[model samples]
Structure formats: C-alpha cells, structure tokens
Target: MTSNDAWWRGAVIYHVYPRSFQDTSGDGIGDLNGITQRLGHIAELGADAVWISPFVRSPMRDFGYDVLDYCDVDPMFGTLEDFHRLLDTAHKRDLKVLMDQVLSHTSSDHPWFLESRASRDNAKADWYVWADPRPDGSPPNNWLSVFGGSAWQWEPRRSQYYLHNFLREQPDLNFHNPSVRAAVLDVCRFWLEMGVDGFRLDVCAFYFHDPELKDNPPNPNRPSGKSFMFNPYSMQRHVNDIGQPENLAFLEELRGLCDAYSAVLLGELHETDAEKLHREYTAPGRLHLAYGYWLLGAEEIGAGDLYGLVRALGHEAHEGWPAWALENHDFMRAPSRLADGEAPMALTAALISMRGAFCFYQGAELGLPEANVPFERLADPYGREFYPAYPGRDGSRTPIPWNADAPHSGFSEVEPWLPIPAEHRALNAEDQGRLAGSVLARMRRFLNWRRTRPELRDGNMDMLDLPEPVFGFVRAREEDRLLCLFNLGDGPVDVDPPQTGFGTPVEGHGLDWASHAGRVRLPRGGGYFGELA
Candidate 1:
C-alpha cells in the first residue's frame, strides 16, 4: 500500500453529527448540503478526514441510529445526489469521507424487521435476533438494553422476542445468518461503489451474539463514571449478548471487502477490558483502527491513567492501531469532562500529539463545553429516560454555533432541532477564528504546524516516565525525534525533563512555553513540543 492508501493510520478524523451540523433546508435540522458548506471549517481546522454520523433513511426513533435503509439518504438529510456532492466537495478539499454504518441493528420499522416479525417462517425471518419465551413467557435471557430495560421485546405474531441492545425500536441484526451478512456487505458495496472513502462501524462489537443464548453474568463491579451510571444496563458483564468470538471472522470478511475497494474501516468497541479487546479486534486482519470508551467514559482522567493507557496500547510497536476521541455525539464535551480549570486548547495539543489516529468532535475546536439543554427540549430517548440523573447526550449533540451574532447562531434560518447555548454562541467559530488565544485558533495553528513533523505520523511513541499531572512522551522515527510534554494539572508546574534528556525547544507549535536549566515550566493546560537535540 502506498503512503496515501494507508491514510487512516495516525490520521485526524473530524466527526460530524449531521443532524446538528448545519441546516440548508431550514427545516430545523441539518442536511448534507449543510455539511458540505461547513467542509471548509473542518479543513481549516486541519483534519485529514470526516466521519459523518448516520444520515441514512430511518424512522428517527433513535434519531438515525435505527437505520431503515442503509443504501439511501433520508429525505430530511438530503437526496443521494446531495451526499455525492458532499463527498465530492470533501475530496476536493483533500478530506477523506467515512460514512457511519450501523450494521448491528435496524429500525423495528425496517422492511427486514417488518417481514421477520410477520410469521414464524419467512425469507428474512432469521435476519434479526429472535428467540422463543423461556416457558414462563419471559425474554430469552437476562440481557439488558444499553438504553434502559430488557433487551428483548415480545413479538406476538410468532410468540417470540427480538433483541435490541439499545432502544427496542432498533432491533439487533442476526449476523449468524450468512445471507444477512451478504446483504449488509452489499450495502457496503453500494456506498464504496458510490465513492465513499470508508466506514465508521457503529457498535462494531455488537455484531454477533452467543448462538446458545446464555445469560450474561452480573457486573461484579457496578459501573460508575461520566458514562454508564444512569442505566441498569451497566449491571452486567455482557458475556453472551455481545463481543463474541464469531465477530472476528465477520470483521475479517468485512476487511476483505474493504480491501477490494482500497477503503478503511474504523470500529467502535464497547468492552469492560478495552486494552485487551482493542488488541484482539484490531489485530492484523481485522479492523484497520479501533477505539473503546476507556478514555471517553473514564470516571476521572489523569496523567497516570493516560500514561497507562498509552503504554498498554503498545505504541512501541504494534500491528493493530488505535484511535482517540475526547468527545463524540454520545458523550459530554471534553472541557466539561476533563478541562477542570484547564484550557481546552492544551487538551487538544496533548491528544493530537499522541501516536494513534484521533477523532476531533465537531464544535470541540471552539472549546465548547456541553450545552445546558432543558428537559422540556430533550430529544434523545436514552437521555430522556435518565434525565436529571444522567443528561444523556443532548448537550453535546446540540447544533454548532457558526456565528455569534447570527440569529440561531448561524446554524439555520429556522431554529435548529437543538438549541445553540449562549455559552457556545460566545465561542462561535467566526469569532474564535479571529482570536489568537482562542482554542480554535490554537488548534488550527498546532494542527497545521504538527503536519510538517514527519515523525509524529509514523513515529515510534514511548511514554516518558514523568511526575503525576505532567505527562510526557517522545515520538521518534529514524533521525527525527520530538519530545512532547503536557501539563494536565491545574496550576503551573516546574519539573525536570525526562531523565533521558529534554531537547531544545522547537518553536511555532503555538503554546506559551518556557524551558531552561534542563527544567521546563508549563502553565495550566499548556504543553511543550520540542525537537530532541
């Protein structure tokens, strides 16, 4: 493969939640054209690619997650032509476009489900996860939905129940069926033939289930953190319901199909043991890159945990690569989660400097904290159920604030599906783009400057043994080696450089830095990027 063919390795992908990106139709929702119009914004931010979330035909029961048709765009988002235009525009900007594929499940309203539930036997009857009652008329197992209660919903026509890891409206597909796999692969071909760069496989681990249908063991350590506390779903270890061994073969098959088209595949892994699963899932023939919620859903993120995670990733030399994301549509913004009192810009520098590929969530460049959406306006079903306790993801999924002074914050002529908070408006891209110290400005400057450093791309990353709250690492390849240190603490800290030796400061990375007498001073949330002398 040529250097350009392996574009996903260490690539910076910009995540776009199309529903909240921009509204070209003025229908209170964002569309493909809106994303095309905003491509320049992402390009200016220096991302290598764009991973647009689901915009496929759907009932919107789970807001495009419950895909009804994978082959076509929903009218609300735009026609297939609009997607073609969006893709063309992105490529023209040198941005690779990756479509989000929710192959694990389909909307209950999907034609496949509609037929599968029609009778005990049909052509597509086994296309979804369906099982008979356990004599007492209860669900097949003790599996629970990630969104709320029982993962099964009884279908009276066949006196059976179907599994749904999320909302019941989103029925889990039965990958155990060969024809089902082929159909989904055909869906992938449809898009690749249409010229998409690749796919961001949604809930990739949930593709297969235990054929015997055993009950998942109770989660011994009740989950708690910024992510899983609100739901009962966190109570189980998820043994039989997901992360099955059969998934590896299916992923390899998917990889084969992707390889034929010279496309890349990124998988989202949901597992308690992320580091272990990350290795298994991304190994040689499986996913090109994979990421779990280890960092995104952490109870508390500190330098120690960050150091451990990077080391565990085996950045020294590993076949399977990993991806990083501080925030996405489903989680609270990074500033609200990890910033504490630190500048969001510093977090940006620290993450982008890491060895693996990275995902830059839309609106994060402006350092926007989670918006405070009122309960009266909540739209996410998962969030609505656990409202006051766990605000779901509505806050992070709100519309981007493009212009501070424009009505509706320049997201649309009509009010957006989700409101743009005043706080976000204050940090709008138009205004932040003009400020030198703003997170947006710093992110752009650093990203562009980092682009010139070849070692950062294919370098061997070694985690530096530094003091707590002052994480350090080195990226080296051949003759070039760069020393990167980040102050993840609250106040300024003066610490000795890594005993191996801190190099001469390399300027132009756009951070206020100081180094002298082999000791470096980093202000709150500031970082240092230097060339190893």
Candidate 2:
C-alpha cells in the first residue's frame, strides 16, 4: 500500500460496536466472526473504513474499554486468528480497519496493575499512579468519576489510593514514567505491525493526570451545561485530574510510533474545550484526526446549527483535521434525538456530505430510532442508576435488524444480548434493502454518489446564505465545484435557481431541479443534492 494514500482523509467510517454488531454463534453476543460476516453490508454502503470499538482482552467492567491484554483479542469477541481473518476479509473488500485503543487507563486485573499493586518496591510498582491518602483519610482530591462518584479508589493491600477517572476497576496508568510509555508504545506497534490501518484513541484527553495530586477547584458555572447535569464529574474544572499540558509530548510520541507503520490515529476528545484541544492534539505531527462530541450532543440539529458548526471549524480548524459524527456508542440516536422524532434521512445525508470526514454508528444508516428499554429490562449500569432521569447508552446499542420476520429479528437463533425494539421489525435490513426510498437505500445511493465527487473527497467548504432551514454549501477544488443544498425543516420550500457550470441535471437520484427557476420543491423531511452544470 502506498503510505501517502491517506484514504481516510475524507472517508466515511462505519462504527461497529462488536458486542452488538452480529453474533455468528448462538451466544447471543456479537464477535469478530459476526463482524466478518457483516463486512459485505458495510462495504456496500460505500464506506472507506470501519472503526470497531475496543475488543481487547478485558474483564468487561467497562465493556472492553478497560483493557487487560493489549495485544490479544478478547475471548468474548474472538481469538487472534479470528481477528486476522477479519482483517483479511475486510482488506479483500477494500475497507480499512481502525480499532479502538484505550490507553488512558487499564483494568485492575491487568498484569501491569497486579504487579504494581503487589508492593511499593516491585519492578512495576510505579507503573500506575499510587498516592497516600490525605491526613483526613478522604479522597486525595475532589475529582469525580464520569459514572458518578469519587475518581480515586483505595487499594487496601498497597495502603494507598490509585486514580481512576472512570470506574474503580480502571486504574489510571502513570504515563509520566518513561518505562510505561515505552511499554504502551510497544503495544501500539504490535498492532500496527499486524496490518491494521489506524486506531481510534479512546478518551484521548485523559491520558495523563496531575503529578502533584492537587484538588481541582470547583467550576463556578458548572450547573448550566450537559456535562454537569449528566454526571457530577463535570462540577469541577478538572485541571488536576486530566487534560494536562504534558499530554502533548505523549501525543507526539504516539504519532512517531504510528509514523513507523504508516497508521493513522484519530483521538476521541472529551472535554469542554475540545475544539481547542483538538487543534493542539492534531497540529502537525500529533493526532491525525480529533473528534469532539459537540454535534453528537446537540438536542436538536438544523440547517443553521449545521452551517454554524462547519463555519466555526472552517475558520478555526487550523492544522487539525475534523472528524464529525451524529451518533455513536455513547449517545442517543439522531433520528429520535431530533425534535420531531421524524426520520431525518435527508438531513443526515446533508450533514455527512459536509467538509469533514465522518463516522456513522451501525444502525444510523437505517434511520433506526432509539430503542426504549424498559427500566426492568435495562442492561446499562449507568441507565439503571439514573433511571427515568437519564437512560443509559444501551438504548442506542440494540442489535442490528437484519430480517424483519425472523425470530429475534434474524440477529441470532437465541435471544440477543439486547432486546431488538419491536418497532424496528418493519425497518429491518431485509425490508429496507428492497425499498429504494428507504433510509438504508438512500444512504447507499448517497455514499455511491459521494465517492465519485473529487471535490467532496478533499475540498474546502463555503456556506451560502440560503433561507432558514436550508443549508447551502459549496464544496470546491481547483478543477471542480459542487453545490449541496439541504432543507432541514418541515413543509416545502422553494429557492431561486443557482448559478452553476454544468447544465444537465443528474437524474434518477431522488432529485428534481429545473436549471431555469432554481425553485426546487422539497418535501417535508426530504433532501437531495443536484450537480451544478
């Protein structure tokens, strides 16, 4: 492969949360074989790559996010051989593979942590952060976990507390230690050498913690935002717990390691100042891409909001390449999150067609609404605690619907790990695959069209001043310029004709445009882009 291909530059990445993707066995849980079986579906979507959530060996405390064995595949997912098979099959289909790498912390069960906690003077004792308790015997600091409690967990055997920004089962690694950094870099190199294309660095900003273990000051304006309301961890400024300035060096070091294998690294930025942090993390030889949760969390999405975000990133993105996503394993589905609960396939197409590279969660292409898991059937620990107040991520993690009539929606012979929403039966892949106007087919057509447009692949975006609810943008290169217009509101709207270099309209693609009037009629919740002549 040519190292400079950079196929991921403007690629559409399909995200596969392995546990929920497909189960080849009757185990009710998905695995690598299941993913291999589904490769055809992903490839058919015109996606250039697939980003699988973490599948490394783990104790399942955080569903594989808390990594145990960095170099081996989890039994729950599959063996190493199965993974190699997956890579072979995916590469044969021309789809790049990007695995999730959670380096911020490790499961307490990891050998490194086990040895670290065995004694204070052991060979790897300092591999993890270990601190004595305060004189008052409370937590060393006021830092809170994202799961809603103290971030510090006590280790009775060591007689000291270890830092865990998330669950107690996940202990923060001491990246300040050169030995630990070298070990992690070796782990990364192991996978890159195995022919993987890239990595999605999980919680990239939380790589290092405050060396002094100082108490974080309270945020004066914490209660007004999503971070504060969703979890108490947002109440503090978090300066002492994570996102330290020293992280830049680690990023560069990681970039260097990736450079050796020509692998790309996309960082998952999870902080209030994520955009600014993304710029620094991806500047020059740092992260290849950094994605923030700004759009993923927007309670409502519209033409104005979409244009505004693109414009802001356009002006401030700098050397940092932007990666956008409207749905992922963590948040609610966009179709349901949107105010009207109306299927917004056209709007989704428009959003993805914008300048940045994007990732789409498994069911997003089907316009699958969020499955409402009853309180009694809730499997997510976070949702169980939050209850009616805040449902957990499981709502968006239900199994993919393949057959509308098959028992368990054809996902498995046995019951799926998650309940397939009854309403999803009618919208299964089998049903939608046959319908041209269905969300699934629309996505297929859109992706196919997108692949042929060089301007969309690596081009600059310019927002046009169109009417409200209509997001108009121009994607251009030295040789080609394409106009993309979208109506993101209810009811029909018409606008004057647009000036273009091309004359013939690209028919048979769900688009009807008269070059004379520019008065294109769009149905409610429907969208299509016309090629300019």
Candidate 3:
C-alpha cells in the first residue's frame, strides 16, 4: 500500500491554514506565495503531505469556507498562478499538496445560488435546498445550526426558505440534484487538472441531506466529560439532518474521479457517531482518510481519554484509516488544552504513532497554545455567536510566528488579519530552530526519525493497557515490532514493559527517557520509542 498511488495511507499531513501560515504579500494575510516560501519548513519537518485549509474565493464570512467561486483563488490568497507555483515547489521537495474542497455549501453570492433564487422557474432553481415555510411560517423542520439557531434562512425572492447548516450567507447545495453533483465534480476536476495531489473535503458529511427534510431528535445525553460545556448543537442527535446513506454513492462518484488522477479524498466527519460513520465511508471505494471531533473538541485530553480513543478506533487492519488531529484551525491548541499546559511532545509522539495518517496543525511544533483573542478580535462566526461560552476558534488560528523579534513575528509586515499572541513570540521558528530541546527541534527530529521506521509507517497496531500516566501502543510489521509510549502526566512515571524480555531503546527519537531497575522511566512530557523482541 506504499505505492505512489497510495502514499496517503500512512502519510503525515501537515495542515496549513493559508490565512495564517505566512505573508509574503505584506498585506497582513498569508497567500499562496507565502506558503511557497514556507514549503521548506514542512519538507524539513518530514511531513509526507500538506493539507491546506480552503483559500478559494469567498466573502470571509467563515474565513474561506464560504466559497463564492470554487474554481478561482480568493485575491486575498493570491491568483491561480500563485497556487501552481506553491504546488510545484512542494512537489520539488517531495511533499504532496491537498487542497480543501468545500462542496457542501457556497456563499449566498455564488452565481448558481443567484440564478437559482431569482425566479423559481430558472434552470438552476433546484440547485440549492429550498423549502416552503409551514402554515405558521416557521422553518420547514426543526433543525439547528452548529453555529447557533435555526438551520433555515428565509429568502424573499423565491418565497421560500433555503437550508443553511452554517451561516445564512452560506447556503447548502442540493446534492440530490444531479446537476449540482456534476458541477461539484467539475470543481474537483479543475483543481486536479491544476496538479494538486488530493483534496481534504470540508464538512464532507454535510454534502447530502435527508430528502424528506425530517426533524432531528433531541439527544438523550447532553455534553459531558469536558471543560467545554453545552450548546444547542450538543442537544440534538442529528439523525436525519446529516449522515444520510445517499452520501456514499456521491463519494463513490468522487472516488472514481480521484482514482483517475491517483488523488486522495480525506473527508471531515461530524462527531455524530463519527467513528461509526468513518468505518462505513472508508469501507472500499470511499474517502482515503477521515477525521472528526475525536479528541479535538475537548478543552483537555487525559490519559484515560487517549485510551478510550484507541478502544473506539482500534489498530486492527480491518478498521478504516483515520487522520488524527489533536489540534487544528478549529479549536484550542494541544499544549494549552490537551493537558495542564504541558505534554506537547508526548501528545505529538502519540499522534504520529497512531495506525493511520494524521494532520499536524501549524504552530504545533512551536508549542503554541491558544492565544487569548478577546471578543473584540474574534472573527469566527461560531465564536461570535457563542462568545464568552465558546471563546471562538480565533485563538488557535493566530498567525504562525517565524521570527521572535521580527515585526508581526515575520508573518506579515503589518499586523495580521488576527492578532499574534505574545506567548508564541518566544517560541518562534528562528528561536526554537536554534534551540537543542525546543518543541520545534524535538518535533522535527522525531518526525525525521519516524520516516525511517517501517513499523511506525505501516504496521498492525495493538493498544497497550499500561499503568496510569503511561498510555500508548505497539506497531508490528514482520521483523519490526516497535513500542511507542508517552508520559501523559506530570512528575515521573515508571512502568514495566508490557512484555519485558528483549526491550531495547531506539536512539535519536528525541525523548529524554531513562531506565531504572527494569522499568522504563519517563519524566513530564517524556516519550519513548523502542523495539521489542
């Protein structure tokens, strides 16, 4: 499965939010050219691919997710030619490029929506999900947006309400319409023709809706077991609103297109039974990889949580491939939220050790925590609506600091579209790159080392039921059986090897571990990679 066509199977995909990666344009916003300049960083870090967040033409309502033109690059992110240069540069460094495809919805300003809403008799009238208001003039059904209130937005022109799972400005496309499906595929073809390696499908589970427009049932159990509390989205089970079986056929159609170019499809599954959905979608000719809120939505992740993750998505060969991301553009950073503001290295070690591909968000290597973006500086629609309770995703989306002392930390000549965090300044690449044990250096060293281990790359996994504060797994392939462990708590943890006979430490894996008596001892933020007999 390690063929040229299947490189994503065990790939390490570094996620780059184009708006915050770098800014060569000096417009205070990162552009394609900026990403080109930073390609070397990802290359040197030894990532197999780069999953770029959406940079398409948009109104910036949801940053770049509300695409206005699927085939064009937003001027804020540079022209189409700029993307070609970035793609070429990345390939030159042996790094694959996966562009984000936001096929579920488009900005209300999109021409398709414009033409569809004009008169009701237009050729594209059915291109978007439109339903008539009930006798009481309420929504067609009881559906709530993850952002806030009702999922339905009234449109005066057609005397109908359109379904918008997100912001009213972003209307959901009618995937039941074959024309819409064909057009979305055309969007994929345009990019594939432009030579991208693959696509990371944004809000992928949302592509299809229940044709019957049924109401979703209320969730029996409300949100629990995390510092982050409840919202209306947490109250519903989302049975009919999403996870429709029709989505599988469309995915097959997408897979066939991707197979033509040997491109991969990585879908973003909503956390409504996401693990179960992940298995179904990745069965045969479906998404090459998928991820959900798994552990990302939590304010913090403990040793037990990590253990539960392994149980839910086992390391067995029959299970679907997963693209794990502890931190992303959507929520709090790992160091700030994964534990009590420590264990960055341990968290990363566990992530890379997992059985399938994973996405490492930018700034993670630098150990950047979630910046305190006040309500005044918030930009995310979800955060803005649920301000104090949610605090928004802007904290995690702050600019990546390249130079600790440079203005705007080398991200831009001017202040970035979002403010840069002071905590991240000292952890900038230049400073951390020079340090021997900095987060950036340790991550780079470990990642580069991992590329040499076949067992870590493509092996059957066995989740280890180790002692408290020590949670990890073993990956075995032929003659190579490697054990990866991390100390998820503070102080030191000493544990007997799962099977103690011929355990030997692997060198240059960038963890400060030791052996005492017969037990492996790990200090706070410690990790161990060893070979087993």
Cα deviation at 63, candidate 2, in Å, is: 1.1
- In TM-score terms, which candidate is top? 1
Candidate 2: C-alpha RMSD after superposition = 2.5
What is the lDDT for 17 in model 2? 93
Candidate 3 collision pairs: none
Backbone clash count for every predicted candidate, in the order shown: 0, 4, 0
Tens digit per residue, CA lDDT, model 2, 75-124: 98889999999999999999999989998899999999999998899999
lDDT of 3 at 303: 74
Global lDDT of each model?
0.86, 0.80, 0.86
**How many residue pairs clash in model 3?**
0
Q: lDDT, candidate 1, residue 52?
A: 96
Query: For model 1, how does the per-residue alpha-carbon lDDT over 1-533 read when each residue is reduced to its tens digit?
Result: 11898778878999999999999898989999999999999998889999999999998988899998899999999999999999999999999999999999999999999999999789989999989999888998899989888999999998899999999899999999999999999999999999999999998989999999999998898757757777778788887888899999999999999999989999998866667778888999899899888768654667898888887766766657889887899888776776373334566677778877898899888888888999999999988898889877999999989997888999999978888888888989999999998888988998988777877776878788888788888988788889988887777888785865767788888876687676889887778877886
lDDT by residue (227-285, candidate 3, tens digit) is: 23646777898888888999999999999999999999998988888878888888789
Ranking by TM-score: 1, 3, 2
